[model samples]
Structures are given as C-alpha cells and as structure tokens.
Target: MHLYERLPIFVFEIEACENLTYITMAIRFNLDRTGRHLSLKDWQALPYAAREALAGYIPGDDDFPARLDQLVSDHLGRSPDTAGDAPDMAWEDTHALPPGLLAQCALADLAPPSVADWAGLTPFRRYVLTKLSRRTDKQNHCFVPAMLEFRLAQATL
Candidate 1:
C-alpha cells in the first residue's frame, strides 16, 4: 500500500458567508513521517483543484511513488503562470510561521545565527527554511548549520 492509500481524504470547507463549499482534497500522505496535519494555507500553495479531483479518483492498488509523481506533475502543470513577476522566490523576514509546533523552530538557538543574520531574505525563503527546519528530522543541529551557510552566503553580497 502507498502512503496516500493509508492517508485520509478530507473535505476542505471554504465558507462564503452563509454558503459552505466542501472540496475533497488529500492534503497529506504519510502521517508519521510527514508530521502533523496541514492547514488551509499550506494546501493553498498546492494546485487545489487537481488535488481535489485526484483524491476521489486514485485507486488504492496503484503504485505509490508513481501516483505521487503523477499527482505532483498534474499539480505543477495547473499552476498559474507568473512569468512577469520577480524571478526570485527566496524568503523574506515578514512571512509568518505556520501555526503550532513549527513556530517553535523559529525561536533563537534552534535556528542558525547566520539565518538570523541575513538582512533581507524574501518571505518565501524564510517560509521555506522555517517549514523545512521544522519538518526535517534534525530540528536543531541541521537547521543551525544551514542557517549559518545561508547567512554566510548573504554576507558576501
């Protein structure tokens, strides 16, 4: 059985005033390795409609990795084009941390001093590292070094 097969397909409710729309979406696959449940904001980053459609269609017997690859490809293919926008997608300091346990990774000592030293990374980068650091196994040692490297690279500029 694949990861998604074991995971649950949830109904994501987007409310507009008095109306409530439930979109069937598989927001996560592995429960233990992938960590806690994802929120609406995280799902928003993905191709929402595609996920919703696939959630109902994918067979339980299908190959796990292949299905995941297809899901990712379909999701990426449906992404909105933002060619004219700025090419860089690094994190900025302003991007707010995701709720719950992930927030704890953002505190000093957990993150590297270099990451803290960076002057003006885009919110996306901050979000990436923040999220990655929290989700990754080496919550302390790894993130600190990665942050230091990021900071060092930034300092050369």
Candidate 2:
C-alpha cells in the first residue's frame, strides 16, 4: 500500500462545490522538510487527486515538520532526518507553468495585455490557471474563460 493509503484522510470544505458537504480530502504525510524543500516539479508529477489531497498539508505549521518526518520514516522506511535534503531542482515560480501552457503562451504570442494580466496574478493563482490551460483536452475552453476573467478583472484597475 502507498504511504498515503495508511494515513487517515479527512474531508474539507471547498467553495468550488456548490452542494457537496466535502469537496476535498487530505492525507497528511510524515516528512522532515517543510514547504521550503518542496519543488513545483514534484508537485506536478503527482496525480491530480494526490496533488489536491496534498495541498492542504503543504503549508506546514508548528507540528508539520515532525509529522513529515514521521511520514517519511513510516512510509519510505527512511530515517527521520533524511528528508532535509532539497531535490536537485529547486522550486521556483517561473517553473510553475506546465509544458502545454508554455507552448500555448508561445503560440498565442502572449500579447502584452495577456502577459501583463497574467503577471498581476498571485503566484498560486497563476500556477493553477496555467496548469488548467496546459491540460490537453480542455485547454481552450478552460483557459480562455480564466484568461477572460483575468483580463476583465485587470481592466477594472
């Protein structure tokens, strides 16, 4: 079983769900590292569900480091202190855009208006929207609407 399987899961409220009592779930992982050691590449490589599940736990707090340590030791069967080493590729905002989105930006020629609008977005928001845009099946519909909303919001300023 995967390490996540053994962890207790909890349902959390999400505004995206209109009627559902629980729109998201979480599985706490045990690791010594906090958000500082996490990489965007590592996060993107995770399955969508796992990514969402892990999001709640990413923002480490007082007990988080210890919990992470325990998770690594328990799941990976590694030593508690082993997770302190950062991944080879460090996490950065520039690398947050998925490949397809980067291609789309290239194709669209990313007008100054769009670039400016996108630049104004918070890193997290930009990350999410870029990922959404990068998806192969729904890129146009999903990304265009988000872009429009972003543009409209920017126009108000």
Candidate 3:
C-alpha cells in the first residue's frame, strides 16, 4: 500500500443511511507501523492530548512514520508495534500541484488549475488535494467539490 493509505487521519464523506445525506467522517487511523490495527477501545484508551497531536500532525520527512510511532510511545510509556517494516514514502511539503493531481482532474474532465491558480493554494489545501487525488475512485467524486470549494473550478449542474 502507498504510505498515504496509512495516513493517521483524514476526512471522508459517507452517505447517511436514512436520508442519503452525506456526512463527513473525520476519522483517525489506529494502525501502527507494524500493521496492527488498534481496536476502538485501545484507541480511546490513549490520552486525548496525544491523540490530538497525532491527528493534527502533518507528516513530513523520511523519519515521519517513526516520529508518529514516537508520538504513541510518549503517551503509552512504551513502544507501538514494530513487527513490520514501514513503507518508504516522501512526506515532503509541496508548493505545486502534483502531476497525479493534474492527471486525476484531466481524467475526470475537469479543468486543471493554471500555475498561478495552483500557487494560490495554501500548503495544507494542496496537501489535501494531493492526498485526495491518490485515493480510491482516483478521487473522481471528491476532487471536483474540493476544487469548487477553492474556487479553482466552475460548478456544473
């Protein structure tokens, strides 16, 4: 799996069962570097502050996955699972629209952002778009809404 697949936190939309209304699920991943999925109880057992830190952290650098493990260790007073090797991923902060993101928009037939328009985005928004584009559906459904939210794309009926 790409390291993005193992992101510690993300926001996704889920259709509400009764009304077919969409709700955002701001979920945190409880998976460890060793590929252990922490049970909900175990995740809840963690100190709230630590959980908050993990949730807000923006992953960067080669040591990031390890740093995330350290976050868990700081609170648990012990190590998180290390029984498996972590996948290598560049966690660098980016300033430009990633090629994959362009491809994603093109494949979906949306207008790709011009360089000036892309540069107007904050790093966090760029990061979210980059991650979202790499996601399931190749981000076909979510990408347009995000672009529209940023005023980078025109809305269609």
Candidate 4:
C-alpha cells in the first residue's frame, strides 16, 4: 500500500529535502471530517496548536519514516491508489492587499530568521491571515487567540 493513503492525514510530496537524510513533505487532511481537503500549504500556515489539536505531527521525531508509517497505519488502516489534486477552481484571487490587514500582519512575530515571512506566503494564506487578524468586537476573542496561537506554532516549527 502507498504511504499517504494509509495515514489518517493525506500528505503529498514525500521526499528527502535538499541534502538532508531525513524526508520532508507537505501533508493534507480532510481534517474537518467533511471530505473537504485543505491544501498542505494552507494547513501548515494554520496555527500549530490548532494543527496539533486538529492533526498535529509528532514533534522532534528522529525516526520519522517508521514513525510516520506506523502512525498512518494506526490512523488510516490502508493507503488508496489515487492521489487527488485540488480542482482548478481552487486557485487564489491574488488581488491587492488591504492596508488594514497589512498593518495587523506587521505586528506578528514570525520565527527570527524568517521574520515577517507573511508576504512570502501564497495569496490564499494571506487571505486567511487577514481574516484571522480582522478586528472584531464579538469574535475578537476568537481571532485574537488564533493570532497568538499562530505565533507560538511558528516558534516550534
């Protein structure tokens, strides 16, 4: 059985990154349990805590290949033959950024070496950040907490 389908989280691009002996790849999930798959890039861009509570990877794992395989088999039972890609309609709008959200992003503390990597993210990721950073009186509790969580996750990753 192929590895991705066996895992509860369906990740793509399982490859050894650069010269590193370890493997690295982006993972995707039908995370809401609704069969709606979020892109791996978008998934990683989400707050790490949420990712963990939702579908977090094991941290500081040394034996990743075995760990990943076992986790997949335990979670998903079997790998499927098809690796589905998003429909063409899923591309981002990539329009001009709103100044208000840009100001909010300016305040985020990304990991030091990659500080302010916000603009480097894809348009959809930027849109999600904008939404999370939006000022809201009622949902302020919700978005505010997410912003903090995203920062914390950034540090660990």
Candidate 5:
C-alpha cells in the first residue's frame, strides 16, 4: 500500500526489554505491508545520484545530516551554506556588514535595491548572509554568491 510502512516491524520480534532505536512511530504507506524491503525494483528505479547518496549514509554519525546537506548542494551546484537561519555573527575585525556583499551589489549597480532588500529581510534572512560573510576562511568564495542569490530573488519581487 505504501513505500515505508513495510520496513518490517522488527521491534515486534525483539523483546520489549531490548534496546531499540525507536524515536517516534507514525503510520505511512508500505509497499509490502508485510515485509521489510523497499521493493527491490523500486529501489533500482531511483536515479543514480539518489542511490549513491543513500549508499553514503553512515548510521550513528553525528555529521550525517550535514554531509547529506553538502551532498545535495554539490549535486545541485547550490551554495555551500545551508539555506536557513544563520547563527549569530559579530564581526570584530571587519565593518558591520560584509564588504563582499556590498562590492558585488555595487558592481551590478543594484546597491540601492539590494540595500533596501537587505534591510527589509526578516532578521533570520539577514543573519544567514552575515554568518556566511563572517567565515574567515571562506569569505573569498562565499557570501557573494549568497548575496547574488538574494539579489535575484528580490529582483523577481
């Protein structure tokens, strides 16, 4: 009936006293509905990239999520920065805002619009750019792309 619900309720075979990795349980569609396989044909049908990504998973690795995020980015030629809220970034050696962001915006003659766009961003969005800019080792290759991405997004608005 579904694709995942059939992952074989191995828990039922294990004694209640045994330790298992149950975090939460939810009902989902399962193809077998009685066994624990992804329907081999279904697995084979997945794109090669997707299969490779799945093959790379290492159970119990703390950085698995980050690795997967990077893989997805690499596959799509996406910005290296994770596309969400950036942690707090306070610049001690540089100007308040990242210079590369400004320079790129100026080069495009979109400074005014970019500034307006940056100013109008929700605090979280602004934080993403600031965090990217603040990474000392990556400033040369990062942030500008992110800024341009935002600039393009703003253009459409």
Candidate 6:
C-alpha cells in the first residue's frame, strides 16, 4: 500500500504568517461580501487585541460588512472603504473541483481528483484551494504545496 493510505484523511498544519490579512480575507469570503478594505500594512499595524477581536468576530447576520467597517474604524481613525457586493460561487459543491482550481491543478501537473476525493475534504480546505487558485492572486507558490499537504496530489521528485 502507498504511504499516504496509512495517513489520516486530513493532517493540516498551521502555517505561521506575519499578519492577520488572510483571516480578513477568509472572513470576507465566508460572509460573501466585500469592500471593507484593510490594507496589509493597516492589518499589521493594528494592536494585537484589536486584531484578535476582529479575527474572532463572526457576524450572526448579513450586516457583517458594516460591522467589519465599524471594527476597522475603531482601530484606525477612519472608516474603511464602503462595503460592496461579492461574487457568489458554488460553495456547496463538493463532488468536483471548481473549473478554475481544476485548471490550476492541471497546469501544475497534478491529477484531477475523483468526486469522492473532492467530497472528502472539509469546506475550509476547499476554500483554501479555491482562494489560492484565483486568477488575481498573482502568486500561487502555495497551490501545489497545499495540494500535496492535503494528499489530493502527488509530489514529483
């Protein structure tokens, strides 16, 4: 049997980052809203307490963008950019890779995962793959590594 067969279905390791910017990004994605822009510099400049609060805050309703703006204004001296509509994607589709992400995997020479394989992943992992494969990301150094880490793709020596 292959070594991967002996491993758990998910073995995620938390990667350390210098700022809370990605948390904000994940929040925006989860909320399906946008335009409360916080620059990376601004994100890094916030006090740890503020950052923690923002990261931990989950909106119980659809008013999250406004709430996020309030948080940003509390930390910074001014309101952030106004909230706007974000594109809705197939967040619930687990049977196949999204077209963009599949294309990315093909470009990387990774095998197209089976439907069962796709459904095996948690939503957060799926979101990570989707976010990394987005066209505007510019840097995708993490894509293949993330795929390998998730055991959805093989590593070529």
The true-versus-predicted C-alpha distance at residue 2 of model 1, in Å, is: 32
Candidate 3, residues 45-118: lDDT per residue as tens digits? 67755554444444333444565567657766666554354422211234455766777788778888887777
For TM-score, the strongest prediction is 6
Error of 4 at 40 (Å): 26
Rank ordering of all candidates by lDDT, starting from the highest? 6, 3, 2, 5, 1, 4
After TM-score superposition, the amount by which residue 110's alpha carbon in candidate 2 deviates from its true location, in angstroms, is: 7.6
lDDT per residue as tens, model 2, 1-157: 4323333332111232222222222221222223333333443444455443444463234565565445444544553333454422211244344456655544544532344454566553454454445444433544544555555223222
Per-residue lDDT value at 110 in model 3? 86
TM-score of 3: 0.48
Better candidate number, 4 or 5, judged by lDDT: 5
Worst 10-residue stretch by lDDT in candidate 5?
23-32
TM-score of 6: 0.64
Off by over 4 Å in 6: 1-37, 56-70, 78-85, 136-139
lDDT of 6 by residue, 8-119 (tens): 2222322333234344434545344454556567767777666655555442335556666676777777877643644435434886678768767777777867878877
Whole-model lDDT values for every prediction: 0.36, 0.39, 0.51, 0.35, 0.37, 0.59
Model 1, 1-157: lDDT tens digits are 4323333331111221011122222222221112323334433545644444434443232443344345555654433222242322233344343331243344433433343344355443353344444443345433444444445222222
lDDT of 1: 0.36
Candidates 1 and 5 compared: the better one by lDDT is 5
TM-score of 4: 0.24
Q: Give me the candidate number with maximum lDDT.
A: 6
Residue-wise lDDT of candidate 5 within 1-157, one digit each (tens)? 3212332222222242122222111100111111223323443444555544444333223444454445545554442332244323432223244564455445544443345455666443464455444444333333444455555333433
Q: Count of backbone clashes for each model?
A: 10, 5, 0, 3, 4, 0
Candidate 5 Cα lDDT to native? 0.37
- How does residue 64 of candidate 3 score in lDDT? 41
Error of 1 at 45 (Å): 23
